[model samples]
Target chain A: MNCIPIMINGLPGNVARIMATSALRDERFSFVPFSLTGEEITQGEVSVDQTTVTLLKPSEREDKINDILGSYPGFICIDYTHPTAVNDNAKFYVAHKIPFVMGTTGGDRQDLERTVKNGSVPAVIAPNMAKQIVGLQAMLEYGANTFPGLFKGFSLQVTESHQQGKADTSGTAKALVACFNQLGTDFEISNIEKIRDPEIQKENLGVPEEYISGHGWHTYTLKAPDGSALFELKHNINGRQIYVSGTFDAVIFLKSKIDTNDFEQKLFTMIDVLTAGK
Target chain B: MNCIPIMINGLPGNVARIMATSALRDERFSFVPFSLTGEEITQGEVSVDQTTVTLLKPSEREDKINDILGSYPGFICIDYTHPTAVNDNAKFYVAHKIPFVMGTTGGDRQDLERTVKNGSVPAVIAPNMAKQIVGLQAMLEYGANTFPGLFKGFSLQVTESHQQGKADTSGTAKALVACFNQLGTDFEISNIEKIRDPEIQKENLGVPEEYISGHGWHTYTLKAPDGSALFELKHNINGRQIYVSGTFDAVIFLKSKIDTNDFEQKLFTMIDVLTAGK
Candidate 1:
């Protein structure tokens, strides 16, 4: 198998580092130079090669791509960049006909899909990339699709907590809210909560981030008339490997779908690729 | 709707009383007399007509059965009888062609199923009967069936605490242990800790039970080869409503699947009844 050489665009993020580690372990892919900023280092960990670092300020991302054009040719850009560069970085990948693997969420999904479509870039984008986690989401999607408005009369309280640096409600939590909304839940992001500490794992709530770390816990509870009955479905994650494994699978999935002759015009998430058939 | 009059056998127990309440509340069914022994009297809280209570000793049961046979010819029996009565109850119900629901657990399951088959009585026998709880069980069943042997290399510590009277591990907890076994875990029930009080909750593990009365929590954590990746799934529940809902659904399901020229012979559990066609 010819190992597809890849370039990771997003630098110095936790997820990017994980993806890099996973890539090094995968036999099907060879490690090329990946980029990251200087500040977002995991304190005291054996740092990556400093020479490979691409220190571009968030504002300087436009010119950053120009510099990369000469350095990485014929390589798929893995965009683990912050949500701020969702468009600018995507545009760069599109203009170059460079297929990309986008694990970065928390951007304008509609605009991003439109960018991928118009740019004609073969890219993989997903809100969440863990197979088991995505599998749960897929089940929720089926419930939302097959049984529209299944949550009728049932009250919903969506709670998700991530690490301390995470400012607000998780994008995945919001994505689930969208899925639940399709199931007829009149829920708003304001109705959801993001906790940094372990003070409140209450009547019906998610455990706090400090208690849950590197862990992703989301719970959807449906209660019945008079508070007499309850139905709860909860998923708890404790590390990033599930996400890394899912992201690697996403790359492999995109590799299979790329048309060497023509720029692909379809916008597909990892779920589509991971579960392409059967 | 013609309310089907039913007889609740051995109705003095707490669980039997729960069934009685369900039977009284259910619009399709009407309670017709009850037989309870000893002095379980709860005054006005459980009043259904003292005259209707048929008090009987264990030795007088055969004579009482003759009297019941003379009066009621085709009434369904909801047998929440003791384990010792399992065989005899099945014989009586089957010989009279009386359809029944058996919520009593802990007897010889093989013998009970055999007796029900030989007697040709359409019966719904289950260890649990709460409807919505069965829905929760259905989710686990779905997870197991869809992703067989998925969570390998996962360290499972299932700490469940029921009421003080709930000696030994819970039946539901044992069932969850079986679920883990299905996923290739070789965990033994005797090895797991069983907490009874708030200190036991705080000592063995840091969990506090003051907040989790009659609570049952199961947590499974999957770690990576380097201990860097972890996935944890924890389901915590408090109270007996799940059991109530599960039992109710089981009754409704059994009633719908009688030998009345409708459905074929199908062995159903909470999983089948809760997901119902899914």
Candidate 2:
């Protein structure tokens, strides 16, 4: 069987680079020699493992993608770009009929989904790509559906700690808030406590010294209205390596769907990839 | 029915004072004018909700107990004393045939339980008295039993934050750790991250400005072996009021149990009170 030709965008970004490196090392996929990067990135290329991939800025991508696509006609794109680029990047992938797996969060999510749903290619779009976290999410979704309003009259407080460089509240935390809301707490996504100070992370959150620049920690606390009880849920990620396997699995899952000619549904989620494996 | 006569101990301690004041306002229980304070207490008496209760230091308790017992014959004692006092207090209660409730944590827990079990007086003993938190505990206990080792191979991290003055890790957090262990992590109680510095609590844990001096926040995070997934549980308590209702309910529940001659079992827990309510 032919290995799926793959182009991983978001060059030089930690997560994208991890995925690009994993794709390069894995025997099942072929890593394309080109990457789509933000205009702000100054590097001409990024080295992943033993291979170096040319980085294309926004100005160069429009003209450069044509030749790259012409050479690798069956190329699949993996996007780990900025939140601001999500929708436009999806449109670009769909316009060129390139199937993709998007690991970025934010951008007009609804617009991105609509663009994919009406487009010619199928794509896996998820705020998170870790298969195990995706499985846990599926479990929470099941709980929300099976036991709606289970925590009625409970007060919810959310706290998330990420690397100091992350400028926004974690998308995973926001998604979990939605689940909690369905479980009966009146929670708003904006109410999430985002902790990014290095000192605070080390002293209060107990984040390790080595992972100070690369971690995601989140906590959700639910209290009974009368202050009689409390329930809490938390997840802490130490580094970017944890996400690689899931991202690669997503590529494999997307390829399988494409091969099966499941073209009617143009969009998929981490949930689809997770369940398909089971 | 006549009000159940009650003596609130641990005068001057914040928790004991809160309970004493609560008992004073409650109509179902008559507050006795006596308290068992630590040896360091120099005050003769402490005021609670317009009532003054004599404070008996450890040196005075034995000599004063006889006189107080004569005045309030059917008095029930509520202990919010020191960890060092738990075992001794239980012995005192058992020796005098005083049916009591012990709300304090620490001490030789097993010895204290055994004292109550073998002694003639019935007692309610619990590490935590928040009804809703107890309820959540019951649910977690259920999960542990029903799904043993459910989180096998998942890495677990426990973090707890309390007021700086707290001298020990939370007994509640310890109990929850046992629950998590049974639910499938090789966690040791000593491994829990205990946050007690005021600055760290406020800045890192996002504790409220007003609650720095009085809060109990706990978080438990579990991650899949490959770091692909994460799960978390958390409970954050502010102020002492949340525990008052559960403590009072325990008093009421103990009195009812005594009234029914259900004295065969001399020891009970918050779990009993919760389920009895249901």
Candidate 3:
């Protein structure tokens, strides 16, 4: 099998660095030396493993793309840039006809999808990139689709806890709350309990001392009207490794789709990547 | 295909009635017309969907078993009896050379397995029998086996809620705690929070009022030592229907094993029934 060339954006971001390190180690992928960085990043380049990746700021990307594409044509872009950069980066990928994977959250999501759906390139976009958690979400989605109103008259409670630095509620939790809503529970995404306090996380939620700075924990509970029955669902993640693993799977899946010229849909989510075979 | 004959014990009880009703509707199995009831019950018969099943008490069961066997010789027994009767019931089934599926909780579980392992009958025994919950448990078991100490230095908290009538902590909760332990979380079964208060279930947990008397809700939370990461798992069931579905599946699985004379391993759980083909 020929190795797929991947241009990983967000050079110095922790998640990007980790993914780049994985790409370097993976035999199926060849890492491109150029990255799309923000204007604020003063560094000219970032080193991942032994490779020095040149950081292409917003102003430099357009000028550099032609030269980079000339050398590593057909390379895919992996985005892990800031939330504000999500749409602009996507528009860039589409205008350049570069197939990409978007791992960044935020931006006007509908507009982001519309940009790809109307463009020439295909992309895999997902707020979460944890395979197992994605699989669980798929299962819940299955339940929601198969048993619509299954929890009719039932009440729902959703609570999510992430690292203190996480500024927004969990996207995965928001997605799952939609599933519960379809299952006939009246719940709002805004109602989801967001816990970011380290002291409360440690004392009340029993978070371990070593990992208070990095985890994703979510719980969704549903109960019958009479308090005669209750159902609770939870998923907790400790670190970034699971996300890295899922992002790579998305890359492999996107490459396969590109290889087969199966681009009729153009835009895909993690669910599509997850349930591709089954 | 020949229909498997099944004798469902603990008739007139809520779970057994539901299972019997399902068995009657299902064409894969023919329901035996007799049930082994507790000695406290004075009723000689119970009507299930127009089928008047004879109730055999302990004193009469010893003699009635021979006659019932004369009629339905290869029938399988489905046990949803009281906790105190779990071990003795298994012994009786073994002595009679009858296959069984035990869904009741609170017996000396190790001894219950030993009895079947030492006997001629193959049984599918599980504490909880909701197929989806069982599938989740199987997934956790896989993780535990594949990544021992994956959660090393993590703290764990287990909470379970059931009907007020339920006298013990959830068997499913206990089983999952064992799995989390294998994953390197230090948690004890005794530390599990047992929630049976209807007010708490409704007011605090948001359990619907109608199902406060008939539900199984469990949550398992694991956190890193430094409180940087967390993972939470939960399963909530509203009624007895899922258990009935799983019980029937177990019966089908056990019958298939018996038909092929695949009795090298005589003990089974809902997990085995679930993953039998996959």
Candidate 4:
């Protein structure tokens, strides 16, 4: 089997380092030795396993991409860059006709989809890349579609706790709240409880001490009006490993889609990668 | 499509009434006219959607089964009887070589499964029968199987609120706790919070007034030890309709299994029914 040539951007970052390491070890893909780093990254190169990957700052990326593409043509791009760079990176990939998998969290999401839809290349973008969490969302989507207004008159409470570094409320929580809204519960996304304090997370929420630096824990609760019924759903992740596996799966899924020239649907979510076979 | 004849036990009970009403209207199954009822029930018959159904007391079920089998030889039995009757009911169904779908939530659950496993007939037994909720549980089971000890050192809190008439804690909650346990969370089922007071349900828990008489709501919250991560899962259901739909699906699934002589797996759960086609 031919190995797919893949370039993982956002090099030298924690998640990027892990992804690059995984790609270096896996036989299904050949890791490109070039990465598009942010302006803040001063390092010229970072080593993953035994391979040295050259870091291309924002200014150097445009001039360097053409040379890199000449050697590794039709390579897939995996982005774990800064949220601020989401739209710009998408435009860059689209302009170069490069198919990509984006696991970044922020940016103008509607425009991000439109960027790929109008462009020639397809891309898979998702906020959360854990397959099980994505599966849970799919199940909720099924509920929302099959039983709209099933929870009418019910109240919802959403609470999410992440590592201190995570600055925003979980995108997964917001997406799930949307599903509950369609199920007849009137819940505002702004009402979500974002727990960032280590003391509160440990004492009140029971987050483990060792994983306090890395985890994603979320809860969505629904209660009936009169006080007789309650429903709560939660998905807690301990580390970033779950995401790595999902990202790899997304990479593989996008490669298959590209291989088949299946461009009818250009923009994909992690849910699409998950339910691809089904 | 041949209409599979089905006997819905525990007539006059709220759940049985709904299941019978659903079966009466559905084209897939023929509802048996007789039901096996408890001895305390004074009523000789119950009318469901214009059809009068005879109630066979526990002692009379033995003699009546033979006569009923003569007319509906291969009928499927659906038990929505009291929890105390779970084991005894399973024995009766197995003794008569009758296939059954047990929806009741009590008795020696292990003994109930053992009775069916040792018997010649097949049965679909589940503590909870809502398809979406069961799907959620299936997702957790996947997590437990795929990532055992994924939440090690984390804490878990399980709370459930049902109709005031529900005398016991939710069986669904207990089953979910078991899954979390396998995922390395040290949670005891006995510690589950059983919120039966209507005041607390309505005032504090946010249960709606209208569904106070009939609803099932559950929540499970997990937190990391040091205060950084939290995961919560919930399934809230109002009214008995969801179970009715799941019951019908089980009946259809069980019927097909029996038709194909697929007795290799006799005891099935709601997860089996939910994932049947897949």
Q: Give the per-residue lDDT digits (tens) of candidate 1, residues A1-278.
A: 67866665555676776677667667877665645333353432233443254445435545666656566555666778787668767776777677888877767888888888887667888767776566556555655554455444557787676555667677667777777776666778898867665445422344434445456666666555445444455566656877776676677767777734333546777556544522
lDDT of 4 by residue, A146-243 (tens): 55665667788888888999897788888899988987889898999999998998998787898788877787777666543456776777767777
Question: Mind giving the per-residue lDDT tens digits that candidate 3 earns over A1-278?
Answer: 79999999998998899889989999989989999999999999989999999999999999999999999988999999999999999999999999999999889999999999999878999988775576566666665665455566779998888788989778889888988887678988899999999998889877676667887777787766754445676676766767776788788889999999998999998778766644
Model 4 chain B poorest 10 in a row by lDDT:
B226-235
DockQ scores for all predicted structures: 0.10, 0.13, 0.14, 0.15
lDDT of prediction 4: 0.84
Considering DockQ, which of the candidate structures 1 and 4 is the better prediction for this target?
A: 4
List the candidates' TM-scores in order: 0.67, 0.54, 0.57, 0.58
User: For residue A45, what is the lDDT in candidate 3?
Assistant: 94
Between prediction 1 and prediction 4, the one with superior TM-score is 1
lDDT of candidate 1 at residue A90, scale 0 to 100: 72
Give the residue spans of candidate 2 off by over 4 A: A1-221, A224-230, A234-278, B58-73, B186-191, B225-227
**Model 1: share of native contacts present?**
0.10
Which has the better lDDT: candidate 2, or candidate 3?
3
Model 1 chain A is weakest, by summed lDDT over 10 consecutive residues, at A42-51
Provide the RMSD of all predictions against the true structure, rounded to 1 decimal: 7.4, 10.6, 10.3, 10.2
Pick the TM-score winner: 1
Model 4 agreement with the true structure over B1-278: per-residue lDDT tens digits? 99999999988998899899989999998889999999999999999999999999998888788999999879999999999999998998999999999999869988998999899988899887776677666656765655565566779898899888889778778888988897788988889999998998899877779878887777787776753345666676777877887788888889889899987979999867765644
**What TM value does chain B of candidate 3 have?**
0.86
